[model samples]
Target: MRMLTYISVLFLAVLTVGCGGVSLPKEDIFSCEGFEIYPDSIVRGNRIYRAVSPREISNAWTLPDSTTVAPEFISTLPMADALFAKAVISPSFLTPEEIWLSLGFLRPEESMQALRSLAWLPENDNEDFPYSTLSPYWAAAAWEVYCATGSRTWLREAYDALTRMLSRQWKLNRSALSEFYCGIPRGVTEQSTFYPASMDEMSRFQTFSASVNIMRAYSLRIASRMAGELKLYAEREWEMEADKLAGAVNDCLWLPDLQRYGQYLYGDYYPIVSSVTDNEANLLAALTGTATPEMSAAMVGELPLIASGVPSVYPYVVNQTPLRPVVQALYGLSAAKVRNPRAFIHSMASVWNLSLDANYPSLWPSLVMKGLFGIETTPSGLEFRPMVPEVFGGEKQLRGLRYRDAVLDISLNGTGDRIASFMVDSVSTDSHSLPAGMKGHHKVVITLSGNDLNAKPLRIFEPVTVPPTPEVKWPTANDMKIVGHDRLLHYDIYLDGVMTQSISTDNYHVRPGECGVVTVVPTLERGSSGYATPPHVCLPDDEVISIHASSITPRRPPLHFIKDPATATNYIELAARHNTRITCYVNVAVEGDYFITVGYSNGSERCGIRTLGVNGVDVATLLFPPRRLNDWVHVYPSTTSVIHLNEGVNKLWLTYVGGTILFNKLTLLKRS
Candidate 1:
């Protein structure tokens, strides 16, 4: 049965070959696990269900109660009321069962019981897409309940609900399949939900997903331990289907050189290709036993770049860049080197800094307190791993680790693995024979010794002055600027209020009045050869900000590619070397709309628009290419095509075909 399941998985994976290729980080045994999920996703998912409570609002716009905390905050937060409420209320989609099923929760069942208030969703079925976005909870809540009680009734109900949901969304109406199938409007309505249908994506094509992947991955992992607890093991077909879905997902999303999976896939198209691979794909692939060697290798090698100690969609990956502290540790661990434990531990400590920068200081604290500092719930009591990273074998100081109500101060005697005795609030523990695992947020002190596993004597404390806190700012949204011949946007440096260096046109002196108005109309390259311009900074690294535009209004000007304008009147080239979002506006009144020709670079195989938002303002239109990048490179309009854009700003962002996009220019003209 296992062999059959594996074979089915491999076959389904072949389907994703059309999705594209990206280089994945080297495999970290710890990182591998199909349907691996982010802690934020669960927390965020729970928050969504709580936000839509009927008692809270009529439409989806009611303000949350300031005094009365929502279900999520109540349970997750450590306050008495919050804890009490979370223990009983059981929000619509949250349940102890599902919480227990989470990979992060050590005592899953206990955690579930702690947040019991969020047990089941309200029983409202069909109203007005009431559950349009909140549908994933059905599976989540059901899984939780089954895990808690091990009741056959719960299992059946959960299975039935999931199957129905799959049928409703993927089969019957086929809603939200891929951007190639249906292009929905963006904004509060679509952006509010995390569970984007394949339509809202470019990497997920003809694949089954949602909470199913997570549930199945956990089920397969725990089946051996649970024994006769759940019947999922008996259903071989379910396992087969799950494997198939995982295979298809990989085939459709994984990219080789880029080393990550697309956010989702479309019909032979992967659009909106962000530089970072989706973390969900990484985790999911690991759990499913379907991760390619290449994928694993890329992640393992690039561990230094991963900030959260896990891959995510945000913080992008750079080639050959120095690894972040935590990532470096994971990388070392992935390589299984005990000799370099200091580097790993020291890197782990530096993770605290990244936490501050990512605007989530509380998050890494949770990990450091629990995972690294060695706080966890194992079958054998609490375990603590206090190995700190040391780049070089030497004496070091540890400070400000809060355990319970006490603050801990410890000193390391040496660089290597020699156990030097140290005092924790006056009590001492040997550095060498530290306990196996530690619980989250516990104070301890010990002296470090020897470079190798050999123990050393206790040494004196060495404390460095605390560095001044640097001001951290979010990256600016206005990174790109478009300028015409008359209006040039350029970059200029102002030293002591006097404009000095400038980035363009001429070396002419600028009037002091026109100083700050200077912008860097960056000279964009057609190929990926030029050094990537550092994100435009408003200040030094202490308070740096990005210069990219977040959202552009009034729509971007239409770009027209010219192919010997004197000869080839209509034909122009469409190419780009990176993923770009281009929105074109057209004012046509004919029943047949204008033809926008999309072209790709040389090795590019697919390209398509990930989103199309139209207010139905464009009068008279036909043939919207539901699928742009596929077996072919260009899309032609059809008389019966539904590709109609509103009269005003028809926003569309084209991406590379199955590969990367290096769009040169757009070919715009009447359909004729």
Candidate 2:
């Protein structure tokens, strides 16, 4: 009976493989599990792209609460990259007509009802479209969509829209020396220097940017291709125009000193070569085939400057603004993958780490499919030329990949393996090519048995060293009492009466066996005004620590406490109309029973109510009785409250409930 059962199972396995029935792996090929942060999803017409939230309005010094404001619209570069990602994972989500329509909406005259908040309107509130520096990208995006879905109607419509926009709005400047149009808008290049995207602030004001010119050249080539596909009469004109621009960029922008294109052109004549190199421009030059072999090699050599896994200016110096931009990183990494896979993999890992820290959107999976897998959708069919990096382990298979109208299950066996034998639909072939214009589910089995995979990993970037800032001294605390100096900084209570941790509020409870030499440390530096040394004290296990509200740090709104003329002491004024809240950081070395005491003064005739919260959780409501006019004496309302605290960092917050109240200090006493 056992022999019969084994024989039956063996036959079933052979039957499944022979019949082109492929099984999917239990694990997803690109899973975000165990990652510190995952990219946020943006959905458009059933297609999703992992996108980073737009820069918070508050980051720009805008006063409106960010929580209430809608996130800014996705920019051109990120949107293009997202489209690419969508095409790779779910090709059906992107249609050439839809992509063209979306790009059209970017025009100011179009009805914004479809785009809503995603439309970019100029600050002047005029109907004039904000001139986009990235106008060429729309043409490139349309070309990609056309390549994925061969729709003549869609291509024609895209061609019309692109020609109208570029001819009327983005008119090329014809140079007297050359027949090619060499001019871009005056401020087109300025858009590249947006903060946290690129660090070319020094060249932000330059009228002519080398990178923008390269992109223009690339966009023209794509437009010419699309025109040829449609048999349009303007095909030759587009091609000639593209050729002229490419020639002019090489003639004017190329710098002998750096052996690469200069950052930008000053006054459209003098090429201003700065110390900083723009990686995005060089990468674009390589992708567009405008860079010479020597120039491409030089660009590859500078990969080390992209230390943060994304392209920032080379030889990154601290305190310099406009850090790494996600768009440059995505494009730069993609360009490097084909020329240098090892460097590409290393940078991918580094960028992944940064994404985790910043919660930035990622294009990793898309790059993996397009660059590593080398999947290109040609007019003929899906082309597969996988370039596996040495860092990749053994056999890998990507299943459930949607290509056009077909669902493909592709498996690659072994690392550093070339296609020894290729089988499509159980047919053996010497050439690893799939039939063009085939629809429906397809099974592809690739067997690779070549040289052993190279196990060594390449380190492409240098270590970044951060400069040290001035140290801040915190208030002192004894086992019996704790005193704070700055209301903007939090304190930690350490063992043995040594201030080990900082607490923001008096809401934390003390645990047993937490007593020792107590020490108080400030979480943030008060800059030059900070203490020369931290304050410390020794106290019994059941001693109490008192913290003044003035010692806690205030994070966002820029205001300082007002000094009392009589006492010569500072106190925070709550009379401002803006919403205000104070946070205190406290560390408890050991958890135990603790009591909290809040000192507040309300001089108004009406009683004031303030909400008390510990570690983001509302714990109690304290009321301040009306005091005599002009009275500023501190009073502890509703006796000290007992609350439990864990053995770690504790945050306490005092939020204004109603009425004006002046906070003085908080006291935390350990219970025996």
On lDDT, the leading prediction is 2
Error in Å for residue 342 of model 1? 10
Candidate 2: how many backbone clashes?
49
Worst 10 residues of 2 by lDDT: 527-536
lDDT of 1 by residue, 177-261 (tens): 2212222211113231222221223222222232233334334333322223344454565455446555654565556665555
6: Cα error in model 2, Å: 48
lDDT of each: 0.32, 0.46
lDDT (Cα, tens digit) per residue for candidate 2, span 1-672: 334333433443354357564322222112221221112322222222233223221111112243321112122223222333332222123322223322221111221222222222232211111223335446655665555556566677767766755554332231122223323333233443321122222223223557667777877787788788888878889888888878877887776655666554432112222323456666667766777766775555544343335444443333433445343444434444334655555445444434332423224443445555555555556666665654444555555555546667776654443667788878877767665566898877767654553323433444332221113232333223333344565545444323345565532334435533333333443211111122122345346565665476552221332244433233444443643577787777668655565666656655454556776687654444445555655553322345556678888776765566566677675543
Listed per candidate, the RMSD to the true structure in angstroms reads: 23.3, 23.8
User: What TM-score against the true fold does each predicted structure earn?
Assistant: 0.34, 0.47
Query: Model 1 shows how many backbone clashes?
Result: 120
Worst 10 residues of 1 by lDDT: 36-45
